[model samples]
Target chain A: MSTIANYGEVQRALQTDTEQILAQIPVSPVTLSMPMDGAGPRICASVKRDDTSRVPASVNVVLDGNPVEIVVEAVGDYQDFKAL
Target chain B: MMVNEGSEGRGGDAEHFSRLFEWLNTNADRLLDDPATNLVAVGIGKKSAGRIDDDSPFCITGFVEKKLSEKEIASRSMSLFADAAAAVSNVGQPKSLDFEIDVIETGSRFRARPGLQFPAAQRGLRGGAAPTLDLQKRFETIRKGIGITNPHRSYPASLSVGTLGFFVRDEGGTTFLVSNNHVIADENKARKGDSIVQPGTLDLTQSELNLMPTLAKLRAQLEIAKLSAFVDIHFHNPQAIPFNEVDCAAAEILSDKRDFSEIARIGLGGDLSGVATPFTIDPVTGEVTGLTRVYKAGRTTGWTEGEVTQLAVVTDVRYGAGLARFRNQLGIAASPDNTGPFSRAGDSGSAIVNARQELVGLLFAGSEMQTLANPIQPVLDALSGALGAKALTVI
Candidate 1:
């Protein structure tokens, strides 16, 4: 197998782990992309939670000694994130 | 009167009984370490209806290896100290002040039992997620042992006061109210300098705090280093360290409005609100040393007392989404006769103090049978190291 195949195996494993986590948690789900240089995983999600619950500012998942940040969707001009 | 004679007759007996309790407490570890004694619990008790050890009731109940006769216990009691033998071998008749040892079923260390009814405190990640109880009113007073809430979580729910715990000072003389991170920090969902409301959002109704007399805000949530040595995290997740381990938080409370020194109903660990007890920390290891009986006032069960049953306990706990493991945690079980429990769901963030009034541990999480706390020494160190707090002293 080529080096690219090895990276693919690791990425697939992370996706699998992410799936397992999502099934257990009440979180907005998304895939984090690992950089080709293996610097870290960058996370972005266009997910919105509609529950009446006040959610956390950001959720973090650690991939390969680095963090992938999951930002809770932005709502309106009522920006209390800095205060909360 | 007959009562007066009874009391006067065993004056010396009661004194001995009292001293024996302290002796037992000091030697608790030794006693428990041995299975031969079969001693599970020991506390002062009333005179049983038929038992003769009434004048000085010292109930010694446990899973006796064998039903120890009064003579055997008297021998054991005499073996404890030289003077104790005199109480056992009093001429013709034995004074009823010997050992009233009763062996029965096993006793367990009490954990704060949680009752989750409403979707708020009742919400869980998985299976045990059934709504069994109903939304009910909680305490209104701003003191310890009353229910509090973190409105910042977006879901207003009730958690216990866990005492006002302590008043920590920054370099500028600013004081902050302390509790578990889950309580004041909303399980890592709060910003520093934000408003932390006492009586929480779900105490009485949506606006119970609005109608109440004292309204307090939890300032900004302060962070502490997850005692990795005290906690167990699978993957190196910096985020999990703040959310999961050591379960403590502090928000600046205006001293003019509410007193951090004052505990809710129970006065500061026996009326010691303002006075600060000196505690010892291993400068090298950051561990609390030489701690004894500790107390905490919570929202649900009110004032509770127990001994540090175990120390340096490492275990995993579940937050909303996942499991976070912690290490170097202190173990506290229910007091004898079930007076105080370490923590329940609402009981998180209570201050655990010793008889000397030293801040010993911070009550954060637990099973229904026992509670766990992060040692206060390391917690205070974490504040200064990670959160920029210096000269952290309890007011």
Candidate 2:
């Protein structure tokens, strides 16, 4: 019985490892060739809601674990919160 | 209404006529309120030092209000004055009659009988004698400009009954009253010994003979009262720094008896009834989002409320430094009759409070319907450092 339980645990761990490998495969990774002095590579991410009519689109950047969100509106245009 | 005093002879007849004339003058406002009484005038009657006659009855030779048919008004007023004249004649020795009524030429076209001296005639009386309409329109304009969401009391500074003084404190514990440097320095030739009467008070209009006692009383009151330090900047160019903006200065108090915090609380108390709070634009969407509720309390307009229509707006406001770009400016577009979000001519330095009566902005300018205000935190910081006292915070 003890041997059967151990085998079950090993199978579960193997499945988790396989899922992790598949998750990374779908995303792309990039590296900066020449980084500017005070500026780091800028990475932008765009997000859209499933119901486009209900929620507006948004853009965000993650810098040093800090997430800055930008709101884009149809009327007034783009605005950065911190800058205002 | 006419009271007829029969023709008679008595002493002090001139004095009696003068009293009657004064009575008519004082009732001008009330008479004007009557729709039937189209034209009202202040008539001065003069008689050659000692002659008397029946033709000498008080005459209504001119018009004061418009809309009263000229012919009809003339006949009616003449009859009324004739009645008054008869009453006066009954009281005193009959005297030769000479009388002139003062009326605004624009509204009242009735000419002054020749050879009778009268004060300068008031203008804009004819088609312009729409005091009711004028008052209503002016009220509406102010209400729209301030974004009236709620009704409040407002009195013109030129016609107010009290004085409003601003005070500031410095780090050294020195308190000062912030006002136009001229207000204290007596620039524009305000004599040093001249009294500084509060705006809208009788003292402001008192003659020298009547002003002495009032001035003396005020002086004595200042002697015992907590006097705020006065600063005289002496900046007197009306064109350079308009009185509205240069109208700002601070008075320092020696004691910490009052501060911005106290003012905030007082404002909140005044706003016990909750009000709508307004919000600025969401920087991300450029969309106006947030609370749309806003309110303001000024010396002139006691307290008013309105809604915010735009946020983060960039505008060109002409201030002391000429036209400058105002970024992230919040615009409150109020509905008609709501006097909030903006200060009028006399409300130059009033602090703008939120629905919670929290200090949020300072009202400085506005149009007939839109008002512009500066956020409170920045003003508090700037003035706090300059005042040397702890900046009052909005709870």
Candidate 3:
């Protein structure tokens, strides 16, 4: 199992991976996905339905790492653990 | 929805018609939720002095498309604002709208005009009303500097910087250096309480941004309005939502004698002595019309003049890497001679004052033919509420 702990690894893959380079980096090998479930940012009642026509949008692309975005929350909080 | 407030009267002139403002703020969601509404703009202002019987009654004005007839427009508007105290619960309550709603129909679909407003030769300089501002005194009272972000050892100076628009105290007695988000916050690179410098990075060498003493701490714009009120930031453009009427930011000044009237217009004293309504609209027809004169004093342009062509305009402006849509902005252009402009590159945060010496708006962006400014009323309100200000005042 691999935990790509930080964005640096993803960035490194994009810059040096031969396969990614050949593919012209069209799709990110490691993409970030913001969960939209009840645990995520608020969504309207309509978002639950199969068709999400009514769900509000997310400027995640333009505002991916931008400062303008306030972090609403995280899906899970983690604590440092070590195997004894 | 015109916001070109023509004149400021004595005594009761500073009134903002707070009840109406708060009413609209609290319940605007109902109207915006319906796509069919297509409600373009809204504004508040008094008539020009002597232009009407009494400029005392601060008016509530709104703007929509002209396709709808006089009857249809009024009928729909009344429906939205109907039943004094029922549907829109806050309509008639105390501290709610005390004035009547006047809806106007715009001739053209509002599309933001954008470009850069670097100074230009005034095709010609004509004589007009003599300026009331004490040029030398105004310059002496305030600090003149650039808007830069985090300067460090390697980076030296932040890549972004621009003009220091104005300085004023919030209700909490906290003083701030006012300018655009791109200017003070470096297009999103800065955080609250970050250090800022004058003679901005554009004006200063990287070495200077590193050496210069910090003049102020950054203040979060506080414009992160309620999420649910807006449709979605997840869309093509975000300003289309509620509560984003301006693109202003502030830095808590270390300590300086700064006021909203840091710079004076060519024809006025350098003091925002009072606040006035943004513009006037016809009660029955909803056509916006009022005081057409306005001016600004900026870093690059110095003192320039122009006409308030349109008020309450909803348009998109490009900055840095993306486009941000701004609504309820004042549009100015060189009249008579099609090429006249009011500001330039280093002038993004200058105060937009009317001929009567009242603070009208905050100059920010521009294009070849148009200069854009966030109307003054909303700027003040955003600071007061979002920033937790008690009694914001422009000296």
Top candidate on DockQ is 1
Chain B fold agreement for model 3, TM-score: 0.51
**Which lDDT tens digits does candidate 2 get at residues B1-395?**
21333332345456657665675676545544554444454444422211244344443332444443457756765333333343444533213323333233346455767663445574434334322211111121111111110000111122222113233445464544333322222223232233322322322324522443444544332211122222222232545421121222233332222233332123322532222243432322334334456665444454556665443333334333233323333445554566343445444445455555544455544544455555444444544554446743222
Q: Where is model 3 chain B poorest over a 10-residue stretch in terms of lDDT?
A: B224-233
Q: Is the docking of candidate 2 incorrect, acceptable, medium or high quality?
A: incorrect
For model 2, what is the error of residue B106's alpha carbon versus the real structure, in angstroms, after optimal superposition?
Answer: 50
| CA lDDT scores, all candidates in order | 0.47, 0.34, 0.47
lDDT of 2 by residue, A1-84 (tens): 012112222222222222222222222221001101112221111112222332233323332344433232222221111100
Off by over 4 Å in 2: A1-84, B1-197, B200-203, B207-249, B253-281, B285-290, B318-325, B336-342, B393-395
lDDT of 3 by residue, A20-81 (tens): 22232122111112221223221111112232332223211112332121121211211111
DockQ of candidate 1 relative to the true structure? 0.04
lDDT of 1 by residue, B1-395 (tens): 01112432365666756776765576556555654454554444443423445444444433433454557857765222212222233422223434443344434543568754566654564446432221123322234434454454453233323333444667877656666666666556566655555554444443543444232232222111111111222322655433223556666655444444433334433543333233333422334446557777666555677766543443446555455555556667777855434555566766777776656777777765557777776677766554565667665
Among incorrect, acceptable, medium and high, the docking class of model 1 is incorrect
- Give the RMSD in angstroms, all C-alphas superposed, for model 3: 25.3
**Candidate 1 C-alpha error for residue B292, in Å:** 2.8
- Tell me the deviation in Å of residue B252 in model 1: 0.9
